[model samples]
Target: MKREKVKHMSVKGGASLFALRIFVTCLAAAAWWECLFSVFPGMVVSRSWLYGAGLVLAVIIGGAVSCPRRKVAVPAVILAAALLCWRFFYVIQGAAAHLVNAYLAVHQERGFEVRFWEEGSLSAGTLAVGTAVLVCVPLLTILLLVIRWGRGKLVAVLILLLPVLAAILEGAFPSAWATWMLIVTGGCYLTAAGAGGRDMAGPAGAAWAGTAIAAVTLLVLGGVSVLAGRAADVIRLEEDGFYSQTRQAIQTGVVDNLNAVRLRMEGQDEEADDRPEEEEQLPREREEDRAEVAAKEAPSASDEQSETPGDSGAGTLPWDTEADGMTDLASVARFSPDGTAAVDVRLEEAPYGTVYYPLRWGGAYTGQSWEETSGEDGRDSLFLSWPEGLDRLEELCASWPSDTVEEAEKQIDRELTQKAVYDTEPGRTPTGEDFAEYFVFESERGFCVHFATAAVLMYRMMGYPARYVEGYAVPASAFSRQADGTYLAVADGTMGHAWCETFEDGEWTVREHTPASDGSASPGSETQTASDSALRHGQAGDQEKAGPGAMRIAGRAALLLAIVGCVIGAFFLQAAVRRKRRLRVLGGRNRTKAVEAIYGTIYDRSRTMGMKESSPLREETCRRMADMWDSIKEQEMRWLYQLVLESMFNEKRPSAREYRKAMDIYRKTGAEMYSRLRGWQRWKYKYIWCL
Candidate 1:
């Protein structure tokens, strides 16, 4: 009964040892993948197959040396330690960077998609933390191996449980890599246990246990691989979906709101023009007339009508020319049909080249009846004010030649326009007395009109001849192909826009101040505009093609295969080395040495077959052998034991016949030992080298 229990323990120990070997090999493979990819990201993409091959080679090497031999084990451990140190200090940062980039790519916020390599995406502090975590992976792996190799099963089990504890703590700060690391660490622990090679009671039981453990591990790993493949697919779908939706929203939202504002402004302008000529008097004249009218009407009017200020009639709207001082200011301009079309014209045509688009250039802000110029250049020049807070703009353009109007315009469009587009929120109207001041300093929100008005005023203050022009500006991207093969630009009320026009060489050049959906300033030149459109279209095409998705799937598949191949290869290599060692022991230099080797092998084999405590081998060898076998085998075992004792203690060489008989006994006992094992154990013994 005691012998049977020992055999069972031996089988269980063999399983553990096999599990440990596979775990170690997988850990090594993962470490190698991280190191290679991080250190050579560009090369990794093309030479990924080479990396996989290298991983297999590393595992084989690890297994060949991780045996009971002192010479091999000592050197392997030293080399492994050195490599771990090198990776921790030098390679960890790049690995961390790679992980960070992957995480951000999958989980970016809506409407703020940014490239991983873009500036400001990764910080020094984040890299530092990531490196530390990467280093910990190898450190933990080494600790697991040491505990397993030292036969500390309890400590080894505790080490395996670390990942579980980490998982419980992961909720505080969730990270995808943390879960992956836990899985990897857990696998490593199992592999380490199996690699120890001490728990098995006999070769048959050990082989059985190792085979069972390996099969289960492979199944679990396969499941994980399938899930990983699915995850890649999901990430790809999400990225494409979000990018398309966000792009569409930006296009529709900005275009629609700008058009609505433009139509409202045009309607108000038309209403103002239809008012009576008598009502369009100068500021002082209107004030005098209003006071006179009020005096006459006050006595006859109701108390409510009289009490209300600026009430031309009982049903006047609040926004009418009564309560607010804003109506007196020119907020909208009229445009001819051709002039409106010019706003949608391609930049190469010089849309503002010859047309004299009128703008509310020169105006004075009084409490009522705001003053306006006669729409002449001289009058417009007279009303242009260089506000006190414009030293910055002046300094920015100071380096330009006095006549470098084009260059100055380009500089302003590029710098200030981009700032307003990215920094400001659209649709926020200015409310302060100084529109330019409020738009630039206090308010961060506005549409085309607000951005254009501020830009025009800023240019004027900087001594540039700039004016605000309100018209329809259609992006070339919004153009439809006509039957004649010419592009016909489309503009609705939503396409109505306000932009700045700077005078240079006797003509006003259009300068767009609005930003596009991608947060870039509207292209300033024809070439730039076309390039921007093409780039956007190309990006859309790329997303539709799903190149990233394919790459992700391929990459994950390669990683999974590499890990599995390395582990299986390691197991085979270790088995081969053990077989070679056994053969060498059996074929010694002399007869006495051969007999001594045979006795030592048989004694060890007997102890492994039964879980008996250590005792003097010379005294208990025959007794232990008798206990392990049945009565029929005991007589033959005793004769074999006597022959081994004579050859070792008497320092005598056995005869050829005696040597042959001893060899026959060893083979027969080994076969009997295997046949006695359970059916599953006998089957497993044929494959795994637990002996």
Candidate 2:
């Protein structure tokens, strides 16, 4: 009668423990759902179903790995800690970079220049979340350790309440609070479920079952949320008229700019015709013969141009032409050091053509620096409307069989360099002489600017519209390959360069005439061709082209899948190995060890199958197993138990025949219990071992 009462009490306690675990798991799952929603609202868009399913799977896997019965919890805790540290370090580094940039901006006249690193700098909300994670991860680790080492309900409840309290206090911030709540509650539940005590066994199965149900429920809720969000978006777009008006305003502005450009170009042509031919043409023969001696006597044209401009604004544009303080020669004659990273460019959409870098254009040199020439004249001449001097250059370009802007640019570049020579010396040009004319006909050996200026003037003189440009240039050789096949080109102060562009097919295309002095290809030349081709082909077959945001989503999804797969694979593999080792012991020649292995397997299987209360099974092993068994199985279990006891304590070994009989009974009992379980129950039994 006493034994029966004790058994009843044990069963009741087990049921209560199971309920507690289920409650904790649910709380944890809810917290996780809330947190994810807060961090990435867009993740719950059209693909809410997928995101929901993924969330459910993540919860289940996290619960299982952290379950006290598994050995992986320690490693999982370590990994989580490492991830937190990495995030902390990343945030600190970004803040430092921002500070440096801010300081530099304050000192410089141009103010702050935005760089690529600043793009990913943490915002206020993200920083708040990161701080929370830093605090929570360590706290959770300590809680897990406490539960693993010393099990108590008070400690578990307190740990679980931390996140709950946080959630309530910051209830207005649902995502953040929910994330905290989920991480705290889930971590606490896992620690409790895995910590083996009197009622641990019964609750193990219940905890797993509750996790599955909770996952499905959350998935359904996520889908509903997605549908509602979509409906709201539709209503919002329909009600908002600002977007339509803004788009119309943009279109109107573009048309006005185009019209302005056309009127300006026409006025420039009229002005050019009115000016004398003598004023435009240089004294070519005299300049060539006197160039070398003129270098010593003439004042630097650069210095003369720099003197304050007259009211006419003949030497510079009406806009600020103050030199950015960089030497004028630096813009035309510099090269980036090999392997320096300058800029990153990505093509987020398809059907995109070659990339172009805009440099100085619609401007003429003031003998000192390049400046915009659009003053009282309505507009400067664009490439489409060339001056009469470009007739020969136009004929040369027309003779080439190029079908595209890129091909045409390439042909023009080759022809421009064929007649030019590169001069390495700085400060070699004679002052007061026409810089372009001297470089082309007299000097013939200046650097990039000289070559570029000559090319632009030559193209224009031959009736093909061209313009000189100057800015930092990144060559193909300086670019490094990225995993996505885009190239990262680095340019520094030394890479400041000058080149030209010609109008083709209604668009201005880059043309490089600078010789490869360092044996490096020009920017957008042969070196980038392979990478460009790869980008084109890579997009051809992608039916569902994604934007930058979608790509980020896809990358994160892939990472999550990888992590989940590894955890699941590890769990199953560990279980399989342990089972195989037990089987090997059962089939061994050592009769004593074999009998012990068989009895232990049977005992664990009984607890796992929930046939006996987990707590009592530890102390009253024989009695608990006997009461849970039927007549035949109970008798068999008692005999095996006694034989295992004799082998362990009395130094009396079981014979080979006895070991075989014990193995047969253990296998038979497990099979019978497994066959009676429902499909989901069987799955739970196979994956999670409470003992």
Candidate 3:
């Protein structure tokens, strides 16, 4: 009997201390809100005050109903409401809505993209912080639940590893590991929490096993990842150029074999050369007039006089004639009296004047600029030249309707302006022919080869002394006149473009129909950059105007949601705590049912106050109460109102004497008992989810 008395006394003392603690906590909470209000605008506003009042009244009524005569309920309800509202205010204005809106707004601005969190935004930092708080509250609540239930440390560990896990799977591996890791982590937490709920505290030995497994799994996964990464690197290197190198080596071997065969066959070439003269006699004799009436004299080392009038040499460069199948020039042309007679004949053989082969032309070794070097280690010579066939092209141009010629020429000119269409350097084929093959059909957008071939064909048809020139054409910028009036020019691959020189009136004249003089931008022309060209095509946006107004509204809405969520969360928790206390005091049978009724009443009040209370509230209750008060007016119950207001809004709760004085006025206010009871119950249920 004596021990029971001591225990009872201890309980009473503890209850009194609890009341004092609540009082102190109320004061501290109010002060915190006040401080926040000072920093942020509108802390003690009409809307907030109304909300806070409503929430506090609901909690009081719920507490009264749950523990009929317990005076402690009044303060408990008030304090809980205030705390919830405070938390909610910060969250809505600070976090969710604000963040979304800021992001939208920033995106609309030039140079204002959403940066990583570390790179702070001046206007949105506060809102971001608020959002951070919003996210943390739910996470913290979950953590608290985990801790209370004594779950496995997986939840804590995952929270800690969030950034690390995020970093690990950023670029590409997330799909592979993200879901698996999440499942593992969740399973661990659930198992631990379940164990705790069952009152079966997990053994320390189990922790060791978990750790061992985790370590081994991580190590195995890490090793596999490393190996895969290395293998990928190897594959990439092989793909880049290693395979090409092997193919080139095989090609080189084949070419060497061909060269060896040619060397061996060379001895028979002299005989072959001699036989042409004898065997060609019949055809030459029959077509004497046609063969003898050559279009141009034979080409010689002497520039001006290589054309030997009647001799015509019966020799030609492979590309000069209508493309012929004869790789052996002298043998093929020998049958024709002056080689000119073989033009139509050769056309039946190899018809393509130019052929293309893929090759690399620019890199570190070759220099970034195509004009810098011919090629590194002679590798650039392997590139495929875009086929520019001149013979076939001339045939087309010759047959072109006069009315369409100018327009066709203009279109071709545009093509020539492109870098891909023009050839600054010739790429040789496997046959070792340095000249790019040209055909009339392919050379419509022809560079120098096209122009030269066209000139040759036209000159032939018009009857003039014209032979294809294979030498490079240097730009005028590279030329300098010598004392003898001969011009010398720097001869580099870039300056080695093709063009034609026709022998007109005993002098060579240049003829080129390609577009504007290449890609070189004169120092005086700064506006000719690719950007400027795109601008002319109307692709650039205006940067001077403000971004769309929708972004601003979004930002504001984000801020508002965060505030509401946080506030509502706080209120729910307050109601939950009150219900728990009542259940403990009055016994679960009566208390639980009463608390439920109280919560329902509070919920209805919340709705009337226009405060949406989602299930599982994560907002502050006090702010909600304050917001509710603004929508009502009742002077008779002013004292109770003042007491609740002082408890929530003051830096500290009112003294007991002050509260008693206010209570006296409250009881005499003539408030209908049913209405007061309903209002109090409504406040409780409204925020019950916060628990």
Index of the highest-lDDT prediction: 2
TM-score, prediction 1: 0.28
- Off by more than 4 A, model 1: 1-403, 422-433, 477-490, 518-691
> What range of 10 consecutive residues in model 2 has the weakest lDDT sum?
309-318
lDDT of 3 by residue, 1-691 (tens): 5336434543553344223222322222233233222222312233344234333432344333234354676466446645864866744444444434433332322223454222223234344334434443334334334533344456655653453343333211123343344434443343333322212122222222333333344444444444444233222222224543554455356643564477567865564345432222211111233222222121112233222211223233223222321122112211111232121111111101111110111111111011111222222222211123334434544553334323443433333332122232222222322122232322222244444434434443333333333322222222222233332222222322233223433333333433333321100101110111101101012211222233333334444554554565455346535634542332223332333333334434455446766541223442453344422223423433444444445634455455444333321211112133354443332234221
**TM-score versus the correct structure, for each prediction:** 0.28, 0.26, 0.21
The TM-score-based order of candidates, best leading, equals 1, 2, 3
Model 3 worst lDDT window (10 residues) = 521-530
lDDT of 1 by residue, 327-363 (tens): 3222321211111111111121212111111222234
lDDT string, candidate 2, 290-334, tens digits: 221122122223322211111121122111224542125323332
Can you tell me which runs of candidate 3 are displaced by over 4 Å?
1-92, 101-129, 143-198, 208-212, 228-691
Q: Cα lDDT for residue 165, model 3?
A: 48
